[model samples]
Target: MTVALMWEARAVAGRGEELLAWVRAQDLAVRPLRRETFRAPQDRVLVITWWDAPYDADLPELPDPDGELVTRTVHRWRFEPVAEG
Candidate 1:
């Protein structure tokens, strides 16, 4: 089974870009990771990351998301892709 990991954060003033840039450089830590922009407001940012994995054990879970996730809260989603697209 494959899973998609979605991460979000609300960045402070001048931190969004810097934080995102840092994440992009962490290619060696996580594999098959893709980042996308959900929205961007002044002094706040909403971003989503998709990570392909074989199973839960193959994923990197962020226990303390607050460090990177600058929002009030964060969430995770697990799903199986539809067939016959």
Candidate 2:
């Protein structure tokens, strides 16, 4: 079954791109549905993606959110495709 994993992460000062870059380098992360949206100031971003498999990948370590507001949240959602409106 297809599943969608919503991942939100906040980056340190100017490290948003760095984090995205690292994930993009991963071979399994080439899924086209893995959309990434970066908030202005390049310090915060939210990634909501659909995957054929579960989100069981190794996540890179970044500065703690509590320390630098590097917030992160992960939620697993069962997803299905419907007729496009």
Q: What would the TM-scores of all predictions be?
A: 0.51, 0.42
Candidate 1 CA-lDDT value: 0.53
**Could you give candidate 2's per-residue lDDT for residues 1-85 as a string of tens digits?**
4555554566676687775665444344255445554454656655556656544543322222343445454323344556689
Leading candidate by lDDT: 1
Error of 1 at 35 (Å): 5.9
| Angstrom error at residue 6, model 1 | 0.9
lDDT of 1 by residue, 1-85 (tens): 4455655556656677765554444443564465554545653443444555555556654443336535456556655556786
Residue pairs clashing, model 1: none
- Evaluated at residue 28, the lDDT of candidate 2 is 41
